[model samples]
Target: MTEHPDHGFLTEPEVTPEVRASYDSDVADHGYVMNLSRVWAHSPAAHDRLFELLADLARLGGLTFRQRGILVSAMASTAGDSYCALAWGGRLATEAGDAVAGSVLHHDDAGLEPADAALAAWARAVTRDANATTAEDLEPLRAAGFDDRQIFAITAFVALRRAFSLVNDALGVRPDRQLRDDASPTVREAVSFGRAPADRPS
Candidate 1:
């Protein structure tokens, strides 16, 4: 087993009183705190910057949270980071009351559509081998109804997710309890997809 490196409680930097107070309130609203949130609180500036970018993505990205979460999960898989896929993807799925297994393994649930699946496939490709992705791969997404804005959001979401995955992996940050406890066995199995390669012979 690949053990995650632990940086203790909140791992990015020092948390300020103001940010800490706000963070408590924010996480309380959801009833759980994500490690990513702690990492951002590692530094006040880091927290501010990350929150700003995330807020902008939520407001102007044109993609729904679930769709963006799928892209994040796929990108994490392509990057060979089980921790990331299960951590974020698991929480995202839990919130929707959807099967985390389907999300982590790249399967479409009633929550996701064909177009969303195509975007996920595209995200995996771009995350793994950006240069290798041809225009043909994008045709399905375009034909399925994703406009320029959604496409842009998908691309951006994948890129940022790759960054997020690596940071969490390197720090050995622990995913929240819901990811470990609330996740179904099937979902835990799906995390292996992150360590598996598509090119491997079946």
Candidate 2:
């Protein structure tokens, strides 16, 4: 097992082939092992399964990269999870724009189009309190042209993201330094809550 002083709350797990593969994938994607990946390395199978399900839901919903960014940013911000907010906000900045991504992170959907705005609103509602959401909450999504299947997929997507965020936040997993450095100034400014970025990249 490779251990780092600042790698979340749990003790580092032994580097089995599964954990090594997870780290390799992170390096391939981001040029470094992400702090979140370090934490999830404890159970690489579970991590892979969660992401697989997320991918399936995304495909079922016909989600574009931008739409996924919106859903993740909105859900993370609403749930007070700065790690995802920063990560997705940076991605959203590239797909949308810095101001728009920052706006979504701040829960100000003014910069979004009607359909995107509807998605953001739905994500927030679901993250804030799923029980508080009524059938009426689906109206805006319907008005924005989403059919029942898409709506269901979108709801499930937000819920799954919330589940991911909950675990990271509860475990004291800080956002990676690369995420903070990569995020636009607008995005950095918008993410004002939850755990801070790690002192250095993992």
Candidate 3:
């Protein structure tokens, strides 16, 4: 594994204007540079593209914010990514209530609407074993009233989220301290199956 980087941004000589711009937005949005953004600082182009994909999905509006959170939590939990699970699971808790968010992360889709449940299942399947998903796997989504375009958008969003999780998990980017400290107990407890922020070697 690549050792965790010491600086939040690249050294001045290596820093590009685009990188600085991205960092500036992170600070403005969250009052600090998120660990994931710092990891992406090494490649500003890739960072920009990842956020662009997120923005495109936001514009699609095929899913509500709460549904997106459930999907993200399901994917992150299935991928065994603690960083995303804590961060997005916290967001899911905020948007959908803690119990609902925790249930999604724990793979219990009991109270979710049929469509939301289908999306959650599909996200977990895609994250865990996309190759194993057959046409039958998509039937639930269709039955739940999702059109082809919506299904396409949801799949794209899941893939993009997995890309972000892969990069963070592979690079050993620890979850931000604020996320670890501030996440609800339910969210914190639900995402217990991956490398932890405290596991980073000194």
Candidate 4:
């Protein structure tokens, strides 16, 4: 077992087969078990299922990697979730560039194309208050060429991402050190809210 400290407010959990699988997946992708993985390992099955649903939504929405990054960064930043903001902001930087990613995190869509800008705005609206959104709020997405199905998918995607962020934030899960360290300086600077990153794993 990796000798890391407890992930969040909860104590470290025993490494059951499911938990080990979750840890292994994290290690395979990131070269270390992420702090969030440790926290989610308490319910590895639920964690896996949540990601599977996210994947399904992404696929159904026909979302490109860059689009996913834009949606996540915009939504996370709007919701004050530093963990997802840093993680997806770093990815958006890779896909779109640091300036664009930083702009999205800062809630400025000036750097994005028309469609992406609309997407980012929609994400923020959803995060800020879903009920506050009206048909008028979705007009830009329609004008930007997103069909009703795609718009529905985008809305669901933001909602699901919000749910994930809620769990991590409410449970006191700090952003992983690796996530913070790996983020571009622009992303790190933009992610000024939410729980601070965990200390480096010993």
Give the TM-score of each candidate.
0.73, 0.96, 0.88, 0.95
Reference-based TM-score, model 3: 0.88
Instruction: Specify the highest-TM-score model's number.
Output: 2
Backbone clash pairs for candidate 3 read: none
**Candidate 1: regions farther than 4 A off:** 1-5, 8-15, 29-33, 95-112, 193-202
Ten-residue region with minimum lDDT total, candidate 1: 193-202
In model 3, the runs with Cα more than 4 Å from the true position are: 1-13, 198-202
Total backbone collisions for each predicted model: 2, 0, 0, 0
lDDT of 1 by residue, 48-143 (tens): 676567556655656676766677777776677766676656756665544643664554434556766676788888888889988888887898
Q: Is candidate 2 or candidate 3 better by lDDT?
A: 2
Model 3 residue 31 CA deviation in Å? 1.2
- lDDT (tens digit, per residue) of candidate 3 on 69-145: 88889999999988889888999899879888888899998888788789889999999888999999999999998
Q: Top lDDT: which candidate number?
A: 2
lDDT of each: 0.63, 0.90, 0.80, 0.88
Clashing pairs in 2: none
For candidate 2, write residues 126-197 as lDDT tens digits: 988888989998998999888999899999999999999998888878999889998889999999999889
RMSD values for the candidates in order, in angstroms, are 6.8, 2.6, 3.2, 3.1
